[model samples]
Target: MTAHEDPDEDIPTGLDAAVTVKVAGVDQQRRHAELVKEIDDAQEAYYGRDKPFITDALYDELMLELQKLEAEYPSLRTPDSPTQRVGAPQEETDFSPLTHPSQMLSLDDVFSIDELKEWMTRTEAALGHTPEWLCEVKIDGLAIDLQYVNGRLQTAATRGDGRVGENITPNARTIKAIPQRLRPDPAQDFLALFEARGEVFVPLKEFAAYNDKLADQGKPQFANPRNAAAGSLRQKDPRVTAQRPLSSICHGLGVADGLAVTRQSDAYAVMKAWGLPISPYNKVVHSLDEVLDFITYYGQHRHDLIHQIDGIVVKVDSFAEQQQLGVTSRAPRWAIAFKYPPEEVNTRLLDIRVKVGRTGRVTPYGVMEPVQVAGSVVSSATLHNAYEVERKGVLIGDMVVLRKAGDVIPEIVGPVVEMRTGAERPFVMPTHCPSCGTKLASEKESDKDIRCPNSKSCPAQLRERLFSLAARSAFDIEALGYQGADAILRAGVLDNEAQLFNLTPEQLVTVPFYTRGATPRELKEPALVPPPGIRDGRVLSANGRRLLENLRTARHQPLWRVLVALSIRHVGPTAARALAARFGSMDAIRAAGVEELADTDGVGLIIAEAVRDWFTVDWHLEILNAWAADGVSMADEKSARPAQTLRGLTVVVTGSLQDFTRDSAKAAITDRGGKAAGSVSRHTDYVVVGENAGSKQARAEQLGVPMLDEAQFRELLEHGPTPASETPASETPAPETPAPETSAPTTRASGAPGTPPETRDRRS
Candidate 1:
């Protein structure tokens, strides 16, 4: 069996016994030996041959299990335990092995927020107080240490076995991002002999382009960007390595002479001044809440960055604090990596099938072998139109690459063509709609998607509309999921969403899917019983009762949600909000000309035309009229508006706030008669900066726009900005919030309060 195979599979006595049967002494020794062999083999395959048969996650799990065993039985622990190693040992390769001046340790990982808090609590107890935390994106790339002598680059090597590594100086020099000579700083104390630790990576876009080039040349493509970077840097020929676009960013220092920085953030600034590449996303914060906010922000925006990131590495900023909590056998005690859920995995493409959406657009999606990624098991992902399938070169029965970034919809990246068998078949778009037997044709000659053109009566279209109506952005009916919508439609209970709010409890009882026996399945399973609303010895299922209740609650939703529930093409929440804010009622919107609707700030010509076209449809108007007749909201109620404290001002809110979500913050600004802008510019009156604020905060500072923290923002919302005449001539006309007490832990950067310090870098 390969090193990647499960250890239980290799166990002689079978799987269950290997786990459940507790063993001690000789048996523990045997199990320890088996784990060690398996882990060592995996390490060799991963580091030496660059053939990681198992995932990085699986490798970590195996190593963790081994550590637990050794901890329980001390005799099993050995000097050569895989847990004691930083990375795999280098085997005989073309490159010469070079020993690092200082051991290159890896980081301990915390998988959950609770675990991270535990680490912080322990750290705070150890130091007698909480230390300033430096947060940085953990770049998923190959680690390299660059040596410099007298400000000139000397050699570069990979992290082999912590103490020793393979020299790849020639390949490292090819990365243009890496500086060959440090810039001279006359006033600064420069380190004469130092080693900078950084990651060598292939940017996401460049990696895609390189993979496309390889595909055109009929060469095998790399699995992921991390692997691509490793493969590129480890090339035997430097010229071959140079062909791929490689980038580098220094996040840390390994060993140094004459270093003068007191904090990690300051060291990064020094590195930046010396012409070394450092990440712009690094941040320094005082509290655990701020750290969590930073993690949350990056977790949501990981893919938006240039390079891939597996997690966020948080370290104590102060050099003294880091020293007090020193290194372990394999990782630093001062730092821990908070890993985001895995985003990509390889799975088999079972088949490609077409789905008819609410607008009658037929979309092709791949049904794949179920694989867990991004905290969920995704069995299928959208392939979009038929052309997308062909463009991605994915075939039925091919092992394909699937990706799910955070909460975004899962999608098929492409097929693993190298693993395809001859039996794999290309997909063909259906000539007719499977739902209604209507001939499929594109609305426009140039359009890639084919539609059913039976939107009014197609079962598939009606079901999708019902599902869309219940979405959180629309009516937010809690019990009406895709399956619920399908069940109601299949049972003929909901012809369309017009009858959604009119669903009677009596009519629902006939639909067997929504009714159950009055008794619970068993006395022990009392939770399965429905609420006390039984009739005729039968009861509505919990979800059925919930659906009815939710429908009643949904009727009071705002005019914008009502508009979104109407299924107008191109009329999403933004456009709907603009239209509702402009016209106020359904009648006004229906009466408005396309030009008049298009004149609204956020509603463009396309959305305006779509809204107008939707109003003209007889069935669509009937659905709207029926819903209105059923007491569904058709107009936004005119309530007393808040005081226009920020009237005529443009404000921008970025990052997470302690008291408000992004939408809520924007709503607070707009409700008080201020224009909430997304990007900062010269016209921006104020930018409310929060924890983990990105480039917009910098842009605000560049243009001399006033900035406010959460407390200041609250003050501004209650009372207008301080008048220019009343404000001191030397200070900007912004709210003045009192600073945190000196005795309290400093919340700002490493230096003086109110003066921001430079951010640091992190490795995956």
Candidate 2:
């Protein structure tokens, strides 16, 4: 019998024995030893190693032949048959229960290129016109559903049995690419909430590295990346899942609310605009021919990619058309998977090397003899970290099995242990930083990494700093980018931050926007001078400049942005804002003792120390002084105006009020003469609580702070600002008098404290 025949009828008494079966064409061995070995070997390679023993075309052919043999001889079919299962069962773990918004479904298979072409022809015939197709890589990993509410991440779940799934919210949050908040745009209303579905998986190389680490730890290693990722995701403890390297790309929508999207491409664009992580490889094609072209292109270039993708998924672009086409009990009729053949190749490991990032984190990489995987020749693959090298027991000159998983990302699956010649050399991590000549310092808290502590002087750090300063979010000098910065640095025109502002237009043009455009014969050089009517575009017009200059002449500006621009260690925008609001001004913050700074709300010892260290630095102090000399304000200019009305009186404002936010009302109080404090306390002179006032108003009553309704407060604000001489002293008391039994303290409660007892009583 052929190796593809089913072997289930006659039970083999021994492992090497064959069983007999009858097919339509002939009687054959039901359990051929060679066929079983081939199946086992292929499974081990495909599932355990992420490397296929044969191409998809060959594998599918064998599977089809086996199925045909089993169909004819039903008695020969076994429960262990590969065709009987969709995927391997999950390993035991603690996972939360989840219900899918919509049912998950599997796609029907199309075996050959001929079959794919035929399916396309039939689809076109039914649709009338050649419907546009969106070609996307079919990611090989666990499918998941993500839900967002009011632009905030709410929950995430895994796909299980196409109907229900397991909740995996916490695990999903660790992915940096998936934004927690949707960024708004002026042109479109941000989606308030929506459900998006995608696949999450570790890249093949990352999976190997992960497994290698586990092996080094003397823990059981997963056979393949997909299995490992699936197992990791199902862990009851989300922290464990978070530690695993995982990434996702949204390819489909589950549910959407308060938003209208017509086309699939538009949906992708909207998702990206909202800061959702969508696949960058999606393409909208005009016809089936274009779809085929994309498939060919991806197949030919897959090895250079990072993630694992099995095939191309083509779908009708228009939502309406998709609806018209409808769906089967399983998959959508408008969509079909155009899979590529699997790629597995043999290559030799020449050496393994470690590379360092800007952050000084060391990562291991492999250098190998060039071998074709998918359609490209690959010479190297990432080994991830030091832990991976020791775990895999990989060595130089080892004969290894390599693969292009999901037709992307070349990976070294394992060594051919039986063929080891004992000539392989062990790999070790470098003792010094690769980018800089500094000694590497291993992390004290974790053995996962070693870093270079010389951040200020590191060449990599300097390059990153220059790039960050010129980024769109920072100073936004569009003409200056990576290439421009590098050229300027090479020319020694910019060695430090202060030198950037000194660059003249003459010096700038000489740096060259384009070498061809500046060639001597091509264009005549003109006498260098600053552009007419512009010394620097940053300067405002005469009147505006005068106003700005006057504002800068004052002591302060809003402190948040100034702190953010400093780029202190471990301090981001949010932390900077919090620090600025608490500290008030740069001078006040700098003058405060370290203990006092640390005692401020939200300012811990670490942050306080950082702040102190920053001020202590001579260069930092010089920069700040120079900025001050150049008329840059570092305190809140708006808060420094003369006290107008309630100056010295502390008040707390709360709840929804007419025509004003709480902040504006508080500003109004400060603008008039009062100090607006956030919380109600015994020291507060008044609590201005509006409609829908809640616990704060109750707390004010309990604390005996005087409370005011919106109208009364407005009246007091409007008429209370007059000079004391305008009021005539009387035995009867003023219109703004407090009630006799109120008991709450008012401005006039402490008679003779400021105004005389008789005058206070008259005012009251």
Candidates in order have lDDT scores of 0.76, 0.59
Pick by lDDT: which candidate is best?
A: 1
Q: After superposition, how far is residue 693 of candidate 1 from its true place, in Å?
A: 5.0
**Candidate 2 lDDT by residue in tens digits, 650-690:** 76776667877865686566545566677766677777766
User: Which candidate number has the best TM-score?
Assistant: 1
Query: What is candidate 2's local distance difference test score?
Result: 0.59
Ten-residue segment with the worst summed lDDT in candidate 2?
737-746
After superposing candidate 2 on the true structure, give the runs of residues whose Cα lies further than 4 Å from its correct spot: 1-121, 124-217, 220-225, 228-335, 338-428, 433-436, 442-456, 506-525, 528-565, 588-609, 627-633, 639-764
* Pairs in clash, predicted candidate 1: none
